[model samples]
Target: MTTDPLHILKTVYGYDAFRGRQAEIVDHVIAGNNAFVLMPTGGGKSLCYQIPALCRPGMGLVVSPLIALMADQVAALRQAGVRAAALNSDLPPEERRDLWRAIGEGTLDLLYAAPETLLRSGIIDRLRNIPLSLIAIDEAHCLSQWGHDFRPHYRQLDALVDLFPDTPRMALTATADAPTRGEIVAHLQIGNDDSFIAGFDRPNIRYAVEEKDNPRRQLMRFLQNHENESGIVYCLSKRKTEETAAWLQDQGYNALAYHGGMDKAAREVNQTRFQREEAVVMVATIAFGMGIDKPDVRFVAHIDLPGSIEAYYQETGRAGRDGLPSEALMLYGADDIALRRRFIDESDAPDTRKRMEQQKLDALLGLTETAQCRRQVLLNYFGDACSPCGNCDTCANPPERFDGTVAAQKVLSCIYRTGERFGQAYVIAVLLGDEDERIARFGHDRISTFGIGKEHDQRTWRSILRQLIAHGFIHVDLAGHGGLSIAEAGRRFLREKPVLMLRTPPPAAKGRKGRAARGGVPVSLDQTDSALFNALRDKRIEIAREQNLPPYVIFHDKTLIEMARTRPANRADMAGISGIGEAKLDRYGEAFLAVIAGHQPDAG
Candidate 1:
């Protein structure tokens, strides 16, 4: 057996070389140094630890927070010819005993355990006796209190450091800003210089944020472009997720609803269906996306605003993980802003945490409202510098901005004149000189700000209001019935009449030119290669069904695309493909070559 990291990477995982910083990370771990790795979701993070586990002497222990994550990783690793297993609640007692025996006998190359399971006295006592090559904490950001996925059990992971002191330890996460990164490092007790931060940019994902107008209609239009592709639609509420899934089903799409509100069996079934089948759309709340290993998700659409930029980044990062072209579209409005603000403000968190949460929201809003390149603004938030990507909505067609000093003063004056206790609809009603009964009862019709904003219609006023909220010129009283209150910045703007540059909301998505609407990410195959790719994919699905595994576990779409493009005629040619390792080649290479040569494999 090869004990070299590079040889293991190629022979087991089937990649010819390390990408970006994987080699540096693997070498550091193999050399017996503690490391912290922050790579993007699809950046091949598993290789950093997986290769080292093969090169090093003993079993690799991975502390995972989710049972599904552990199961998925173990399955994928085992498929890649690594002897991986997980001790989780799903395993029967007999099976657990068998796995324990395997671990004790040193027959497993990698072992994954949920955080709680790892902390069990029986498990730790056994692990202490076994020779350990390394300890890896996946999704290490869950240990940070500042993160959205905080798990109490993750805090207990510090015990692993003492229990396996001689084993090289590493913590890995796909999402973390500077503060969260520091917390993970401190909690793991890794030195600052040992941390590796690969570029967080997922260049394959084309980002598009649109103003919410006729939201269902907007989502429908967006879906038109993504027809027959695997994707996710994230709604803020449980009811919305179900409704969206039902509506999509009514439209002839294979849509499923998944959220915390469902029965455990139902949720698992829906998740399984989405993972195993192609072109299944999962309409879910924020609860649906972590540890999802599906690699060909073509799009991620947000029907509502995420709580923070980090949440947004991580959710969207789930798409295009296989490095194929993908799209992320968010339809946001004033109500989303208000609901998210209320969620943060009404939480039991301390004052400092609330302030931090508010700042993160503001950053997301800034990205949504920016007239500059969306990718540039998004990357800047993570402290990664990049040029205008020309692959986002703004770069494809920049929004027009106008000097809104007069408009801003008018909006602020309207808010101030209305006693600052009214909701957005009422304020817009007053601004538009509408004389409804509520307006009459409140006597807001007589205010000086009444009819002042009539030059721009109601829709225009709503857009301006949402932008103002995003810019921090106004705050929403979500707990108090979604009232709009002017902020200090609004007061200053009103007093000084500073020029406010506001972007005109982009036009509704036309869903034209297919993927071109999504900044032209390459999501399709040409006519000549499309047939072969589909044939290969059909074969992959057939084998996956026979084995009861997700199609991606056999080979990702990118790998299939390479096969179709290259048309490999023999096992050696197939082995040269990116994901076709020696184990895979030995297992199914001849069958694939047979397909390429236009013959069916024997059914025997």
Candidate 2:
């Protein structure tokens, strides 16, 4: 085997060059150093450790969090003709014995195991005798309590440092804020100087957030453009996941549901179908998509707001993992915000942790309410910046803003005079001077603030209230009856009479429209190329079915697009295409080349 990292990259992984700081991180690890890597999803993070492991003498041990993630990575590596295996409870006892035999013989290039398995008494004792090239901890952010997805088992990974004192260790994660990064480094005992902080940016994804007026309709409209494409629809509750999946199926979509509440076998079947099939929509709760390896998910839509910016980033990052054009759509309303806050307040965490969680939620709310470029706000949350991206919803359709101080004051005053115990609908109705028995019974109809808010419509007033909640000027009584009350900031605002600007509620969407009608990102392939692309996908699916693997494990859509356009003619030409390594060239070069050749003009 070649000891050169670049050589292994080209001949084994089939990439012509290293991306970003891959080469630097690989060299540092090869030199027997510890480092932490922070790169976006689909940023080629695996190569940072894989190359060094291949170049070094002993096998690499990767600590993964999920059995499915381990299986997927091992499959992809073996497809590239590398010796990789995963040890988890999913494996049969016979297969486990075989893997251990291979490990004893030093025949494996990489071994993946969960932290719990690695920390087992006899397991660590046995591995201590074997030579280890490096210890890689994937999804390293789980070790940090400050991270969005914290696992107590991951906190025990620090023991690996003392157990393997001489071996290089690398911690890698796709989502981590500044605090989370600090916690991860401190927990893993990695030197501060050894950290490589790659900027967090997934430019291929278009960000869009809509007010949750008609969530089902909004989601349907968003799905129109993604017809016959694979995606994930995230819900906040298990029952919602099942209901949403059923509703989508009624609409003639291949939809499935997944959540922790389902039976274990049912959950696995749904996940397997989602992985193996095309054009399937998986409606799931937050329990899904922690370590999903599917690279062709064209979109991720959230029917409910997530808890924090970190959670939002991690979930949305699952889309567009193949460097292709994808989208992230979120529908949020006052109720979602209130429910999220209630979750935080009701948790058993200390006040400091609750405050931290609240701040994170506030940041997310700010992102949802910002009129600036969504990408800029999102990137800035992670202490990164970028020029205005023309892809997000804000950049495409800039919302109109108006002076809303009087409007805000009217709503706040009404909440106060009405005893601050009514929901938004009743409050808006009172402001609209609706001659209802409930309002007259409470004498809210006579309040001075009631008729004063008649200038703006209910939608406009709702927008103002949402923004006020986001701005910390109002608090939601989620624990009681979802009522609204003025916060300290709102009191100060009424006293000081400061200028306040709020986004005008966007006009109701006219009708159900497809992506083209909504000015969505155009398909990358043209008419002629699309035919060949379709043919290549058919071939890929056929090969995948035969091998009992997901289609992407055969080749990514990006690779197929290149094949269709460039029309590589032979094995050597196919080897030059990205993702086509030497082993794959020998196995699949002719099959793909034939498809391309048949689609040529002269050949027809």
Candidate 3:
């Protein structure tokens, strides 16, 4: 009757109002009902379990895949004054036993563990003895054979649901197509549990796709669009990860590479460095995205196409977690698909696995080929209805598609006139009326349509080629190596009629630095007391150093920056910054106030 949930939310978690159905989901879990939560990246999935853990009489057992993810979540929870600990391989036996004792003694409210360990002998019974109230599965889709990221350990987790049938359980994921969702429920053996689908509209995440050409340079250019913001760039290979990280460092960006190929200790070091350090961009492969709990990542870029749309959605969801505007840019080519296909085809996976892999590949192909609003296509796969995001590249810049009957003739004529023996660059040069050495050597200057489309610039011609390939209007002969061949769509465009809507490239990003200019925390009030903010941050670091704790343990970068801007003169005014909870305010409040008072009087 008193809305105890609202009181708990504001006082315990510091959120004045619930985001979306977070309060409802917590209410459901607290009511002792099993729930399946399908929320987007920033959708507050943790609260479903965390809040329930606090409300329920006993501890909650959270099954998670990544140790770093579990550790980060535990760190954040403990920071907010919750009692949490993690059991993982990284913990020494002494520490693991101590943690187990804490859980048994009821000193811990939540405990996180990997499935591999949970499935180990005697762990389930040990958990039963601790009076667990709920069992939550994070990244629950990994149980799906239909998913890109399936784990045998997750298959073993189904045993837990049967063991704790009476106990309410929650399974959560960010990206699960319908098939994967069904697999998660069935695999978890919670077929009758309620499922909640938070809207998949990552409205704050602007999605864009760029055709691959000098992908590393394109990545650099793209990062420049959102400069100085923290982001993640996913690559297909470890070599590229290292190289890209190095190149970004050369350009004066704080970048680091992470991959499975590295030593375990080294990977852990880099991951810690990234998590604890602010504005450190981690260039890693798919492995890096899975267990990360960093909430402030402003962008996610794929230097290569993810293996499936499911994978793509999950990777991109990692951005915009703070619910502010963010960007997800994918630079892809057919070769990326082929490489993953080759890996799958050549692997020793069983025939069933191969078939599943093929189906996943087909879904990705459908996504790439469809000219429909990408948001519509992406959401449709999840059985959700959404209008075109109107902000995506496809919707905003409606490509100037012609009934390629004319330009196709120009393209095909240039190809035909030059005997069709060239790659895209030479062909584009011919179309652009470039009288270069290559054109003369190939005698393309003598072609009929050589200068016909001089009205269009080279970039426009390139975009046309990209759309042609994307729209099935042209084919790049992978076997002919790099030669362009007219496909049936191209033939139709040339002889019959094919409408092509050309998409205009977005304008250049302009901002303070070379980083991405698109996405970040809102510049609502110009939080740029840069000198004062820097000074406050220095004080926070000095205090953290003196206390021998991580800087975040004192106050996160965001909290310190907020104090610098608000310049709150008193304790009451200091309480409004995000992440500055009562405990943090009481512990470090006076110091922050002293710094702010030293700078100036109350501005807010």
From the highest lDDT down, the ranking of the candidates is 2, 1, 3
In model 2, the Cα lDDT at residue 162 comes to 90
Query: Each model's TM-score?
Result: 0.95, 0.97, 0.83
lDDT of each candidate versus the true structure: 0.86, 0.90, 0.75
What lDDT tens digits, residue by residue, belong to model 2 across residues 143-255? Answer: 99999999999999999989999999999999999999999898788999899988898999999999888899999989988878889999999989999999999999999
lDDT (10s digit) by residue, model 3, range 473-563: 5556555666766667566667766455555433333331333252233333343465567667678668756754445556655666577
- Better model by TM-score: candidate 1 vs candidate 3: 1
RMSD of each: 2.8, 1.8, 4.5
The 10-residue segment with the lowest total lDDT in model 1: 514-523
| Model 2 Cα shift for residue 393 (angstroms) | 1.2
Candidate number achieving the greatest TM-score relative to the actual structure:
2
**RMSD (Cα, Å) of candidate 1?**
2.8
lDDT string for model 1 (1-604, tens) is: 6888888888998989999999999999999999999999999888888888888999999888778777778888888899999988789999989999999899999999888988999878988999999999988888999886788999889887777778899999999988899989998889998999997899899999988988888888777777678999999889989998999999989999999999999999998899899889999998896768888998999989988888999999989989987889998998888788788878999999999998999899998999999888888888787899978888988899988778888888888988888888988888899979998998888889889888888877888999998887888887789888999988877788877899876554555444433212234666556767778888999999999988889988888889878888888789999998888888889878877888222221
